[model samples]
Target chain A: MRWFNFVLLLFVTLVLQLGVGRLFGVGPQRVMPDLLLLLAVVLAFRGPADQALIACWILGLVKDLSSQAPLGSYAFAFGLLAWAIVRLREMFYGEHPITLIVLTFLCSFLAEIFVLFICSLKKVMEVESYTSFSLVIMFSAMLTAGLAPYGQWLILKLHRQLGLPRRRIYGR
Target chain B: MAGRRSERLSHKQIFTYLMMGAVVCMLLPVRVTNHLDHVLSVLVAPFSKGSQDMSLMVTDKIHQDDSGEVPSDTPEEPVDATIQDTNRLVNIEQELKYYKDLTDRLSGLRQNQSLDRARLIVAYITGSDSSNQREVKFLDRGTRNQVESGQIVIGWPKQIYKDNILNDEETDAIYEQALSGAVVGRISDAGSWTSSLQLISDPGMAMKVAIEPAPQRREDWRVKGILKGKGLGQISVHLIPATVPVKTGDVVLARSDDEGLPMDMIIGYISSCRRTEKNPVEWQILVQPAVDLQNLREVVVIKR
Candidate 1:
C-alpha cells in the first residue's frame, strides 16, 4: 500500500472527525459517525492482510492519541475488528455495498462496545446509565453504517492511488 | 492443505501478539500517555484549529441567516462599523464596571488578595473530544499561556435585550445588571499549545456551587450545594434542604476554592427543581448554563 497516501488520508479524516464532525452531531447526545472506523473497515476489506492489520492498528492509535480514552483502546478495537474482517473476508463478497454497510455498522458498534468495556474496566467515566450509553453507541453505529456505502465508494475510487488490490468480489 | 492450515495459525498467533501489544500500550503510565497526547495534539493543532474556525464561521452564518440578521459576508458600511465599535466600547466599559464591583466586594470582605493575581487568558476553541462518552473541548491556549489543568474556563453571559421602551440608558442599565461570569468548563489537560477542557456537562464533573438570589430578589441568603454534571447537557445540585426556598431561575454560583476563578462566578440557573421521589428531604435541582457551552467559539481561561 501507499503508506504516505494512507497517512495523509488518516490525518485528514482525524482532523475532520474531531473538528467539523461535531457540527453533524444529532440529538442531545450529539452522536456522531465514526469516520476513522469506517476507513479502517474499508481498507481492511481491500488491502493485503498483514499491511491492513498494521494500518488498522495505526488508525486506532491515532484515535487513542486524540481522545480522552486510554491509550490503545481504539487500537485494540480496530485491530481486533480488522483481524476478524480479514478472517471472514473469504466467506462473503467483501466488496458488495451491503457487505460494506453491515460490516461498518457491526464494527462501529463493537468498537464502541469494546472501548466502553475498557472504560468500565478502568472505571474512567461516570456514565449516567448503561441504557443511554448503549443508545448512543447504537445511533452512532447506525449513522456510520448509513454513510459507509458512500465513503467506501469514494475510497475505492482512489484504490489505485492508495495502492490497494483491485476489487474482486465477482472474480479476477 | 497442512501448509495452508499452518499459515492461518501463524497469522492468528501474530494477531494475538498484536492485541497483546495493544494491551501493553493501554497499560502504559498515564503520564507517558498524556505526554504523547500533548505531543500529537501540538503537531496537529494547525489542522484542527483551521477546521474548527471554518466550522464555527459556517455555523455563525447559518445562525445569522436563521435569525434574519444580515449576513456577515456582506461588506460592512461605515455605520455598521461604527455600531460595532460602539458595542465593543460598551462591552469593555461593562467589564470594567463588573470588575470594579468585584473589587469592592472583595475589599469589603478583606479577601482581595486572590483577585490581585487573577488573569483571564482568552482562548479559541480548536476541537473537541470525539468520543461519545466524553464531553470535552480543545482550546488553542495551553501551558505556554499559563493554562494549567483545573483552570476555570468561562464565557460571556448571553446578552439580554429588551424589546420596548428601551433607550441607550436603559440598555446600559440592563447590561450592567446582567450577571457577567458564567463558568463553562475546566482545563483537564494542558499541552504546549493546546489543552482539553472538561465541560461542565460531562458526567465526571462536579463542583461546589451555591443557590443565590437573583437580581430581583432582595433577600441575602446562600444555600451551598454540590453541583454534579448529569451528561447530555444537564447538571444537578445536591445537598440542599427541601425547606430552602429554592425555585426555578435562581442563579447557581461556583463556590470553588480554586484561586484561578473569583468567588461567586455564575455557573447556571436552576431549570427544574423537584423533591427526589426516594428522598423527601432534599431538592433535585437541574441547572441550565447561562451561556451555550456547546457552541462557544471562544472562552477565557482564568489563571492565578
Candidate 2:
C-alpha cells in the first residue's frame, strides 16, 4: 500500500471521528460511529495481508494519540482485530457489504474488549455503573455497524490510489 | 520453496512483535506516553481545529436560517428623570459594594496562594474525546499560549449583566440564569499546542468546593466541602454538615484549597441537598453545572 495514501486516509478519518463525531452522536452518552474501525476493517479485508495489519495498528495508535486512552490501547485492539479479520476473510464473500458490516460490528466489540482490558490494567476505566458502560459499548458497536456500508464504500473507492488490490484475494 | 516458507512465517512474526510493542507502550510511564501523544497530536491539530470551526459555522447557519435572525441585546427603556437620578445613586452604591466583595474574594484567593492577579486566556474548543470513562475536551491553546495544567476554566456567564447595579429583579435574573463566571472544568493535560480539559462531571475529578447563600441572604453562611464527580452529568458535594442550611438554589463555588486554581469561581447550583441516609452527619448535595458543558464553543482559562 502507498504510505501517502495511508497517511491521508488516517488524517481524514481522524478528523471526522473526533471533530464532528459529537454532532452525529445519539443519546446522552453521545455515541457516534467509529470511523477508523470501519476503515481498519476495509483495509484489512482488501489490502495485502501484512501491510493491512500494520496499517490498522497505526490507525489505532492514531486514535490513542487523539484520545485520553493509554498509548497502545487502540493499537493493540485494532491490530488484533485486523489479524482476526485477515485470518477469517476466506470464510465469507469479501465484496458483500453485509459481510463487512457484521465483521465491523463484531470486530468493534473485539477492539473494545482489548481497550477495556488495557484501561482496566492502567486503572482508568473507573466505571461507576456497569449497566451504563455496557450500553455505551453496545450502542457504539451498533452505530459503527449501521454506518459500515457507506464508510466501506467510500474507502474502497480509493483502493487504486492506495495501491491496494482492486479485488479481494479470498472467497473468489 | 524456502522463500515461500519464510514469507508464510513472516506475517505471524511481525504481528507478534507489533503486539509486543503495543504492550510495552501500554506499560510505559505516563510522562513518556503523554509526550509521544503530544507530538503526534500536533500533526493533526490544524485539521481537527479547522473541522471544528466549519462544524460550528454550519451549525450557526442552520440555526440562523431557522430563526430568521440572530438575537441581540436591546436597549433599556427610558424612565422618569427624577426616579432615574435616585436609581443612579443607588446603583453607584450597589456597584461600590460589588467591587468591594470582588476585592475581598481576590484577597482571599491570594491568601490561599491559588491566584496572584487573575489573567484570563481565551481558548477555543477544537475537539472532544468519545471515551465513556472520561469527559475530556481539547483546546486550541496549550503551553505555547501559557495554559498550564490545573488552571481553572470558565464558560461565558449565562447572563452578562448590562448594568453595574442589579436591582432585586436583575439580581434574581442573574442567579437564576447562573453565576457571574461559570466554572466548567480544569486543564488536566497540556501539550505544546493543545490541552485536555477534564470537565467537572468526570467521575475521576474531585476538587475542594464550598456552598454559599445567595447574594440577598444577609446570613453569612459559608460551608466548605469536597466536590466529587458522580458522572452522567452530575457532581456531588460531600462532607458538608447536614446541619448547614443548604437549599436547592444555593451557589456552589470552587474552594481555594486546591493549589494554583482560582478561588470562588462559580461551579454550579445545588440541585438537591439531602441528609445522607447512611451518615446523617453529612449532606449529599447534587450540583447542576452552571454551563452546558457538552456545547461549549469557547472558554476562558484563568491563569496566575
Candidate 3:
C-alpha cells in the first residue's frame, strides 16, 4: 500500500478511537477498543514489512501525543510489540479468527505491561494496585481482540480487491 | 540460501535497533519532550474535540430514549407512590430551607457562598489515559474554558424511578435530585483546550465525606469522615468512630470545600459499613457512587 493511504487509514482510526469509541460506555471510561493499536496489530500480522513498521510507529506516536504520558512511551511499546508479533507469526496459523483473537489479546496485554514499566522507570505515575489493574487490562485486551478478526478481514479484503496478492504472512 | 538467511537476520537486527532507538529517545530531556507533546496536542485537539462532541450527542440520545421507555417493576405503582410521598416530604423540607435562607438574607444574617451552577463550565471527557490502569480521563475543555487543575468535575445522575407514571406534584423533586448528582473527580492536568481528570476511584485519592442526616431527624447530625478510594469500585471512609450513628443506605455528601464542591453536593450512598481491620475503632464504609462512573456523558466543571 502507498504510504499516504496508510497514513490516511491511521488518521481515520484515531478519529474513531477518540469519537465513536467513547459511545460504547461499559464503565466510567468507555471500554472502547483501542483502534490505533488494533490497526497496528492488524498490519503487523498481515501487511508488508514497511507498512507494518510505519503503522506501528505512527500509531504509537499518536498515542503518546494524545495522552499525558511521556513521549516515545507508546512508540517503543508498540514497536517492540509489532516486532514480537512478527517474529511469532511463524509459530501459529495466521488466517484463523481464533489465532487473530489470541494474538491481539496477548499483544495488548504485553503492550500494557511494557508501557507501565516504562512509565514507572520515568516516575511518570503509579497505579494503586497491579492486581486490580490487571483485570482491567485483561478486559481491554479482550475488547481489542474481540474486534480483531473483522478489522483484519476488512483490510485483507481491501488489499485483495486492490490486486495485492495475499502474501504468505507466516514466515515471510 | 545462506545469503537470503543473512538478509532476513539483518532485517531482524535492524528492527531491534529501531525499537531500541525509540526507547532511548524517550530518555531525552523532559522539557524537550514536553514541547514536542504540546505541539502534537495542538494538532490533535481539533480532531479529538470534534469526535468527543459526536460521542456526547449519541450518548445523550440514548439516555433520552431510555428515559422515555418506562421501566417495569413488581408492584410498581404503590412503590412509586411511596417514593413520591417521601419526595414530597423532602420537597417541603427544601422549601422550608429556601424560605429560611430568604429570611436570613433579608435580615443580613447569612449569605450562601457556593458557586451557582450556571457559572460552571460544561466540559466533555474526550478519552482515557490507557497507558496505565489509573482512573484518568482527558477532557475537551482546558485553560480556554478557564478550567484549572484541582477543579471538581461533577456528574448529575438521573433519579431512579420504579414506574413510568409521572407524578405532577413530585416533578420538581426529580429535577432537584438530578441537580444533586455526585462529584465524579478532579482535574489533575489542564492544557489550553484539553485537560485530564483523576476519578475518585483512584487508589490514593481521598475526600472529606459525610452521611447526611435522615429527613426525619430534628437534629442536624451529619457524620463526617475521610474517604479514600481503595480502587476496584470501593472507597473506605477513615477516622469514623464506631460509635457514630452511620449506617448503610445513608446518602454520602462532600463534607466541605465550598469552591471545588459544596458541602451539600451528594457523593454517593453508603453501600456497606464495617469496622476497620487495622484500627477496629474506626469504621470502614463502602460507598456505591450516586453516578454510574461507567456511563458519564456531560459533566460540569466548577471553575477554580
Top candidate when judged by TM-score against the true structure: 1
| Each prediction's whole-model lDDT (CA) | 0.75, 0.72, 0.65
Please give, as one word, the docking class of candidate 3: acceptable
Ranked candidates, highest lDDT first: 1, 2, 3
TM-score of every candidate relative to the true structure: 0.82, 0.81, 0.74
lDDT of 3 at B256: 40
Tell me how far the alpha carbon of residue A101 in candidate 2 is from the true structure, in angstroms, after superposition: 2.7
Evaluated on CA atoms against the true complex, candidate 1 attains a DockQ of 0.54
User: Better model by lDDT, 1 or 3?
Assistant: 1
After TM-score superposition, the amount by which residue A169's alpha carbon in candidate 3 deviates from its true location, in angstroms, is 4.5
RMSD of 3: 7.0
Which residue window of length 10 is worst by lDDT in model 3 chain A?
A: A160-169
Lowest-scoring 10 consecutive residues by lDDT in candidate 3 chain B? B159-168
lDDT of 2 by residue, B50-160 (tens): 887688667757755346765443222232232223223323333354456667887455343323245567676777774545678888788998999888887643223
Model 3 stretches with alpha carbons more than 4 Å out: A25-30, A68-70, A118-126, A160-165, A169-172, B1-112, B130-132, B158-179, B214-219, B230-233, B262-264, B276-279
lDDT of 3 by residue, B68-123 (tens): 65344535445534543444454344445545666778867644444343246766
Please write out the lDDT profile of model 3 over residues A1-172, one tens digit for every residue. Answer: 5666666676777666655564564575445577778888888887766457656877888888755567788888888788777777778787679998998898888877777666667766546577766777788888999999898877877674432347646565
Top-lDDT structure, candidate number = 1
Among all windows of 10 consecutive residues in model 2 chain A, the one with the lowest summed lDDT is A125-134
lDDT of 1 by residue, B263-287 (tens): 4567777899999679999998998
